[model samples]
Target: MTTWNLNGMKHHLFFCNGGSCTKKGAEEVVEAMRDEIKLQEADVRIHTTRTRCQGRCEDACVITVYPEGVWYKEVTPEIGRRIVREHLVGGSPVEEHISYTYEDELAARPDTKEGQSKTKRKEAQTK
Candidate 1:
């Protein structure tokens, strides 16, 4: 395996390839994203990783972009390409597909499916 030197990179994207995400067509999304990156000549400005379950199966095909902590869900190949074209390159996030983002803490994007339980269990809360 080749170790990467992430120097001068602007963003790191984690593409979920867990069972649920795969079932939802993550492979196509991944390929589309990669191809778009190459087509747009952003290989050095961004890095991508294939990850296991991000615990957001309800939002299958989830993708997380770091340095900004923005998460996008239910991504199709077209949206995957757009994420590379718009967000990674154009300096603006794609609003409609966003699932979560970080602003001091992880904040869910409005109207997105819950990635965690809406209510904490009483016993768990006690801990």
Candidate 2:
């Protein structure tokens, strides 16, 4: 395995490759994002990792960028590229695709999709 030099990485992207996201074309999004990062010349400051389910299966193809802690949902290939250009390169979050963002805490944006069952987390929280 190659050990990465991540000293200059400002953003860590967690690309979900879980079952639901795989069905939703997550691999393509990952590739598109990586390609765009290179094309936009933002690779030095950004690092990416593929992860299992992030518990937002309803919002398949989730891409979470850290430090800023922004979670983007329904990321198509085009949106993946836009994330690299606008957010990674331009230092701005893509507002339209954001499902959740962390301020002092994790805040679900108004545009967050409503399919996730509240009962699930409520049970986990109560446990």
Candidate 3:
């Protein structure tokens, strides 16, 4: 099978509606993210996917960011906007709102200074 490339983008935000989350405005969050992405013309590819039972029923609504692998439960439209603006757009993980964790190594965006420095350091050492 051929793997689909996400084009080496920074973050991937997944919103899980999965019954419980739908009642908590998960759809609204998705729409908001779509609108925000268009409004800002952001370079980051905000992949929105629906999953079953994010396993945080108490938290209900959930959104997971990859390669950072940070999960945000009980997400709202406001929170969604913040995620896009702060974490997705800013290139930093939002600690206060983080939920679950992912083991996948998230690639850093070359646009950010820290990411740039890391890349430079890696390249220099390789030579």
Candidate 4:
């Protein structure tokens, strides 16, 4: 058997195939992505992985790509193919499908006491 280093891969893709996502056609998305990758002969550059719940039940059939750390929501088979062709091959992210990014998470965090107070005030106002 030949050992491969995961770090060497250019893109690592994870498809959430858990119960919620599967109900949303996660299996079909996975199949489409695999087919596209094989068609493009990108197996050497991209690695695909299956994962359980990503905790975004509302965004079922989520696809996350790294090391860019972009999370795409509500992925259909067609969207999967586009992601492979446009994002993986063309080196561009499918902005329409992107639900969130690592930068979004960072920006949402309240780093200072003043920021935390402001966030709490906003939440209270919404309620």
User: How well does candidate 4 score on lDDT at residue 69?
Assistant: 84
**lDDT ranking from best to worst?**
1, 2, 4, 3
Model 1, residue 24: displacement in angstroms? Answer: 0.8
Per-residue accuracy of model 3 over 1-127 as CA lDDT, tens digit each: 1216667556666678788888888789888876786676674465556677777676667888877677776677887788788888886665556544542234333443334334565787799
| Model 3 residue 117 lDDT score | 34
In model 4, residue pairs whose N, Cα or C atoms come closer than 3 Å (at least 3 residues apart or on different chains), thus clashing, are none
CA displacement after TM-score superposition, residue 13 of candidate 2 (Å): 0.3
Question: Which should have the higher TM-score, number 1 or number 4?
Answer: 1
Candidate 1 Cα errors over 4 Å, as ranges: 1-3, 112-127
How many clashes (backbone N, Cα, C below 3 Å) per candidate?
0, 0, 1, 0
Summing lDDT over every window of 10 consecutive residues in candidate 2, give the lowest-scoring window.
Answer: 112-121
TM-scores across all candidates?
A: 0.83, 0.83, 0.68, 0.77
- Local accuracy of candidate 4 as per-residue lDDT tens digits, 1-127: 1228665578989999889999999999999998998899888788988999988778888999988887888899999999999999998888777776665333322432223333565687799
lDDT of 3 at 107: 33
Model 4 weakest lDDT span, ten residues long: 106-115
List candidate 2 stretches off by more than 4 Å.
1-3, 112-127
Q: How far is candidate 1 from the true structure (C-alpha RMSD, Å)?
A: 7.1
lDDT of 1 at 107: 42
